[model samples]
Target: MMRLFIGGAVLVALAGCGETRDGNKPTGEATAKAAPAGWNAMDACATVGTPAVAAAMGKAVTGTALDPVSQPDGLRAGFSMCTFTLADGAKLTVLTREAADGDAYDAAVAAARKIGEEFGSPAVDVAGIGKAAMWTARPAALQVFLDDRRYATISLFGADFMPDGSEAARSAATAIARKLAS
Candidate 1:
């Protein structure tokens, strides 16, 4: 009887061990939980920036829902701002904000342009309309803007980037720009 009880307890423990824990593998549900479904890495960044700039501006620029990473150099400070998804399986990182004091903005812009140029993307595959852009080392894209009045420049860096819903990003930018203007 004693041997049978011990054997039964061991069997119960083994049975529980084989059970799958929540999110054991990269299944549809697990992937969905890991990241937003139907969304790529770039889309993750693009969807950042809130619509309520008028209210939120001037107080304090708090952190955002989308996780932001900052890379600061002597001449320029780059921030991964927007994130979005692409048709292809690539995660995009939208880098924005290159702040400087005097000629820092210009230097930042030059650095950014140089970085993009160095990417040396082959002929842009999209309809091959314009010159073939250079592809960055990582799967990424960039949108750069200079704010002369604010003396700050911003770059939208994308990873696994796509042009989906650019209008949405533009609208978000408008709000952010307005805030920055003030």
Candidate 2:
């Protein structure tokens, strides 16, 4: 399961490198939208280290410095990320993406779906996390599309990891989703 999960995540990350599965380029209009009104792209750093997330992990987690995403097109796309490392060297990454409108949001969802399909594990809808939420067990990742024209992905990685059904990752992701929604 861990191997499948890791493989799925790898496929997802690689899919982000270029055009969609249909070979269509993402239009500028879709990627040009701003983040929700109050969202600062930089806040992703703090979100990863929230007290709620620490509690869910059952251990103190230290966040790494914020890393700016550099896309090949140089479009900002309101993307930011940071990783929280646990005492056992396990890591969880928090990813924030701008989805100011339905077009952007839909595109993002499609991309996620394609990634899941590529890994032979299609995304399954998850209830109550956001406007729309999905989880791919093999990768043990959770993705939430909040009401604020923003979306987030929580990915788990480490030598010691929990199964997808475990509450730890889901709980932490939910806690972060609540923060993002607010």
Top candidate on lDDT is 2
Q: Taking the tens digit of each residue's C-alpha lDDT, what string does model 1 give over 35-79?
A: 223223222234233334223222223333343444434333333
Candidate 2 is scored at a TM of: 0.68
In candidate 2, what are the lDDT values of residues 1-182, reduced to their tens digit? 44335434533543333233344544323434444455664566765455756776777776574665533233223566767777777877777665323344555566776655655667888777667888765466777776435567777776444543455666666667766766
How many clashes would you count in candidate 1?
27
Model 1 compared with the native: what TM-score?
0.31
- Among these predictions, the greatest TM-score belongs to 2
If scored against the real structure, what TM-score would every candidate get? Answer: 0.31, 0.68
Instruction: Report the Cα lDDT for residue 117, model 1.
Output: 41
> Can you tell me which runs of candidate 2 are displaced by over 4 Å?
1-38, 69-76, 162-167
Model 2's lDDT to the true fold?
A: 0.59
